[model samples]
Target chain A: MPTDKFQRWVNDLQKAQPVHPDQTKQTILSAMHPKRRKWPWIVSAIAVAMIIFGVSAATLPPVQEVLAKVPVIGKLFQSAELTIVANAGKLQGVNRTQSDNGVTIKLKSAYVQGRTIGVRGVVSGIDDHATTSGRNIVYHLASKSNHLHMNKASWNLQKDHAYTFELVGNVDHLASGRKIQVPLVFTKMFGKKINLRFNLELKAGKPVKVAFKGQTSVSGYRIKVLSAENFDGGIGSLRLRVTKPVNERDYLFGISNIHINGSQKDYGLGALGKHKSTKQSGIYEFQTVALPKKISSLTFNAEVADWSKPEIYALSELPNQLKVPNRAAMYQFQPASLHDNQLEFNFTLSGTTSSDRVLQNDDLPYLMYLQLADTKREHAIVDEYDTKGIGKNRIAPILYWVESSHHFMARVDLSETPFKDKTLDELELVVPSAFEKTRKLPTITIHNQK
Target chain B: MDDIILAMHGDLPALEHLLLENADYLERTAYLYLSNDTDVQDAISDTVLQAIRGIKKLQKPQFFKTWLTKILIRQCYRRYSKRRHDPILIEELPVVPVAGNELSSEQRLDLLAGLRQLNDANRQALLMHYFNGLSILEIAQITKLSPNTIKSQLLRGKQQLRDWLGDDYFAN
Candidate 1:
């Protein structure tokens, strides 16, 4: 059987000499070489003459004025090395360190903005650093009023003596313009723990309201943007209200292609809250970055059904990876490992599904739902492992998954499903379907609050 | 291949040899992404300089080919981004035979035209897989994407190409 002439075409393309390889090599090598100096004495004389000429050229008022006019050239002349120092903002340097058993933790810089508090530093003084199964360091931010911690606040030590430490955690729960004594706590290092406290003057920004007057309904789902606010640390929030939420095994259906001032902004996981009376879910999530200071218009595009329902097949029918087209986006599902009780798979999404090319900085979370049936019993696992409300499911695909400039990659764990009890021969994977039309909401304007 | 290990230890001659040997692969890969000869030349030069400067950072010497290829691809991306608005036309190049042993001249043109319709990432993925005979995992490493993503891109690219060149030309 012919494996498609496309493969044959590609094989033939290997022999196609689009560009002369040797010619390219020669050109590159020639370009890389510095121009040769014909004579040493002449070269030295020319260098001295050029230096004298350059001095006179610099002193002349006309040259100075022309150089001044070109500020970029003037900047180049001002410094031999071009290093632009950024304004570190109002955040002060803690410059604190803790030393124990020759291991030192140095606090380099700290800043507080809106709900995000970022800290950068270095851990040094260890002669030989090893990564063992149990030898791990955990960090947390604790204050009298607020407490936040990350058990897996991991850092990798480079070839250099210092271990790079950078941490950014949201502090939206705390009040702005408040002087808070936040303690930086560390645990489980060399069988010991350490604590460093810093006095931070936290500032939280007020969010601008994003009130869309007319709600847009798509496939029985009503969506509207409630409010948007700019916060410190280049963080912004968009509060959303969704009627009749779509449930997933791991995470909720998400919104994408959020354009503010005609530019799409990456979105993080929005905090989901269900109203006690109406049961309507209000999502309070932060944008990947802050919005511009002012906006004349804002548009929100939500993914109603991003993925197709799971399609089940026998073990023999399943390829290593199955690619299915969903409108503009192509979803590829690759089975990583299958066990009696657990199934793991990786998925990739590509193509121009939205107007905005999903940037590398954007975080796209996967919500996987798994259902398995066999002769003995039927089992279903809705793995909303991405959402916080579901369980202790802290399996963030954003951490393991990659959102490349070209596509999105994610891995799913379905160990808790009923696959463990079934026979090895055949089973069913429930197809969880989602529609893929990005609904652009009506453009709206919000007045600034006094 | 020992040149990679020698180059990792700051051996300039070995590094030069390794680069000269892989020049064809780099040029072919760069040409697929970039049309302009000047950009292709510039990308190769830059890739060489970056590879030399960043060799110590290479974790494994065995992956030296893929590492060099990755740097070259990134340089192609940079060139592509800079020259996006003002694309250097393929008409500028001197005439070269597009026809191969199996593909006719018209079919070759059709294939090239179809490739132009695809995005830069997909085109590169296809060329890397079929032309260079790189596995999905190798392509994944070079593209800095998951293996699954590379497989998807290759499959999608093949489908798009088949769509353009007629289904009869690419019957399964």
Candidate 2:
């Protein structure tokens, strides 16, 4: 067998020898056409560069000049017509569907607003559609003190999908050529379920046997927890979640911190696009538990503050490598330290008269995050985590990934301003993804928190 | 004596002869790239034709080998792009046996199959290394990469080739 293998290898080595053939220079001098190959690459690059920056460049004058001859190609670029009507108002050129440049768009919305309305229309034209070039696009709302709200939380669409929506309005400020990527944060469900509503209380200690029972008008849930660390001195929050059905629509529900019954530090965070809003993310689970309930299902519609007995079993947390060692993380406030003070917060869920159920997935947790925004003001690291309860009130201690055990320090004087009620909307769940489908072009309907 | 004669007289035809002599290796590069028998020949013919017309532009005679390598690689890419009508299923091609490092006709076809798994740049880097016997610096010059990058690519290519050939194949 070895001799047979040696013979086969010897024959292969001889066959693999380099074969040299002769050639002449005259035969090589025949093919020459540099003009044709280099131009297309240059043209494609110029078009891409022009589309990247807002200003038009030298490489694409022919695109602008020849656009006048193409009717469908011209409309999406040259000019857009704007008109406005109140709820049950007139829609001009009702059936006039137009295609311009490379964009084909029409107003398909028959629904009107009884209240003040705001919607923006953006277009990407021919030089874009004819050639596969990305365009510079963005959008901004014109109304100040306007709530850019949506009609529903879940809109029967998957992520990364784009639909062309056109709005004709007297507010010409919105019709500018701005391209924006869709956010992957929220999805719209059926009817009108826009943002989420959360109810949390910052009590002193853990409650015994906490039982949360309610029937949701819609199939949805939230997160709940007990916070032990206050900001600097007077600022604190008790986090929680109502875990239940989760789907694309659940992400659209945004939560706003209403108030701390008596002691809120007023963080002055009432601005649109600020990150200090509702703390629900579609990432992972905030800890949750379900006890036997008297009702078939609970409506997250009710949020009442009950602090009758908050201290049940002492907070006992899971020992994790992420935690600091030898330092007592969880703190207990003395009942005698202050007067009877309770936090009162009202959370509202808008969209489709709050009767939408197009989304139903009871797996993902509806989470609530109480981030310690300012720890530098206070000089002590209050990193704590434990679940303790005996009856109707349970406490989940504040948990954070502090530095390694020896180098961890937390400062807790977070009382310059306390928690006030905020609003969450369809835009809150979106405006973060890079696709074209989840663009939260602002609307004008202000969400009410009364 | 020969070094002085070559240094002073500097034979241009001899230099041209060297590039033309390596024409077969350049054709093999084009063939490996296009994978089509007809397009490979066309790319080789076009590379030789372009090289002759632009011989004056080849002023740096020392870079002739790398320059010729670029010509063939670019021609192969162009012809490959043109003839490519999206890849088809393997079943569409006739059942030709692959080349390998063996004596039989089937062995030659098997070795060609092993080359297809590499991305274009890796395949070109390997060809310039083994088939053309170019140094890492020379291969770097043709591929427009740094010498260290070429070294890394060669190291990675050897590991990848070993993975394809398996342990028993390389052990002996």
Candidate 3:
């Protein structure tokens, strides 16, 4: 049959030899069953022996001291890269185990400071083929009242198909020396159900509240450190408010170089939480590392994009498509249509660099702050926009690569910003400068903390 | 079918057996999207890893091939998107083995080149429908497009291929 010939051609196409045919399966198996490290097993053995002999280990202060010094659960904290928790002085050893379906989960240690709670554990007896992404495994830690607010959790695969896990969160109404029953549940592990609960005796300490009233102005932007709370194990939360120019088009792109204790070293800020922003100012909360017991100093820099000197081009004057030069790639913007208070553009990026370099260097989307402004220079309120599946939002543009067409696609929507009822002829598309000016603000130091 | 069940129950040997059974199909399907042999191998390895990890989540064991094919396609697209800028080397093209077939080696090369020229959607639709022998509904389910859309794409893709290959090519 005619179709049979085409099928033969496709079959012939599939006869290509794989580059690493001999080692492909073995490589995959090796990844699934990584080589076991010797130290963790030794640590596990020593800790297990202590647990077997020291029945009243918690009651005995000396035994508890030894357990604290070499806790098996400490391995979980170390595996998670939470050095603060691993080196913490107040870690309490739980050393409890639950087993089902040949799988054993051991809760090793926990700590409570203020409302913050940290628990570390290990899961063993996973099949070698059960090599799923760590993201698929879900761990839920809750109390009977369900007031335990989980902040962060991580699980790392260990040798012998085992996994070390860590959980950090905040709990409400946790008093010092109060005993709480914390139930840790693994809803599904390798398609099996496993539930483990532990009765934890909480020895909570209060997190010191540091009054951070520092403000600095740089490049027409005011950055203020509102407040901060210092928790045990060098974990802290810093709240900041950045006030931008009243112009809606002007944007405070980013704030970085956050350092404390007058040290030049950057401690690296973690996830941002509780963000409230408006046209004028934005309040941000950040989880930081190595917050000192005493507040000495705090410093940071703010980057602001000043749109006062934007290059204005009329909608009629601009071409249908134009190539803009970029560092790692060339950006092509094809203006599709401008009708009914909506303007559309197809943005494509093409480059001859590695994917990582292209992804890191492609900043046209951030600099492509196209806005529709009237002759009076009043900008329109951006009502809604859709980049299809390309760009994420107006501020943060996440460009998705189109597999068929070797370029990234972004569709911009500017309908309701300055004027909802203005014609295309009466408005001009404003293009902001591609570069943001960074300014270092004066360091603010705190004094007289109890 | 027993293998699927055992694999779902965290049996490593069973999972390995299942992957080996479908290895050819996975590699071939990935080759349709990626040109590089190394990329195709990476995609296959990723498919196997993901299949082993997520086999238990497969509600219907009968759809194992379909599930594995979907994972392979995703991995192929990921590599394709990442390495799109790399120049395609002519030497890297697969050497076609001559067999007792109607189409000449030159004609086969033309067909492969024509297939590559089609857009991603049309090419995927044509390959899945004709090469993989997937029904329109199955293609729609896998591609997350409507059945009607898949049908149109298949029709358009076949027409485009016919136009490129010419009437004499298909008449053989």
Instruction: Judge candidate 2 at residue A387 and give its lDDT.
Output: 12
Ten-residue stretch with the least lDDT total in model 2 chain B: B91-100
**lDDT per residue as tens, model 2, A134-231:** 11111111111111222111111112232343321111011011111111111111111122111111111111222222212223343322111122
Query: Which has the better TM-score: candidate 2, or candidate 3?
Result: 3
Error of 1 at A263 (Å): 5.4
What are the Cα lDDT values of the candidates? 0.46, 0.29, 0.52
> Per-residue lDDT for A314-422 in model 1, tens only?
4324454444434454555554445544444455555533442221212122233233334322222222221111122222322122323222232233344334354
TM-score per prediction, in order, is: 0.34, 0.24, 0.35
The alpha-carbon deviation from the true structure for residue A350 of candidate 3, after best TM-score superposition, in angstroms, is 14
Error of 2 at A438 (Å): 59
As for candidate 3, its clashing pairs are A379-A418, A380-A417, A380-A418, A381-A416, A381-A417, A381-A418, A382-A417
Kindly list the per-residue Cα lDDT of model 3 for residues A1-450, writing each as its tens digit: 226766777777666423333334443453344344245435434543454345324322110000001111112223222456567666678898888777788888887654456788888877655534322232334333223435455567888878887766644332323334454444334434555545666555444556555666665666666666666656666666677656645443444566776777765444343233445665555556656656666766544434345455665555544433333445455644566755544555455344222133222333344334434443221112221111112222223334334454333334434444555555454444334222334443333232
RMSD of each: 29.8, 28.7, 28.8
Which is superior by DockQ, 1 or 3? 1
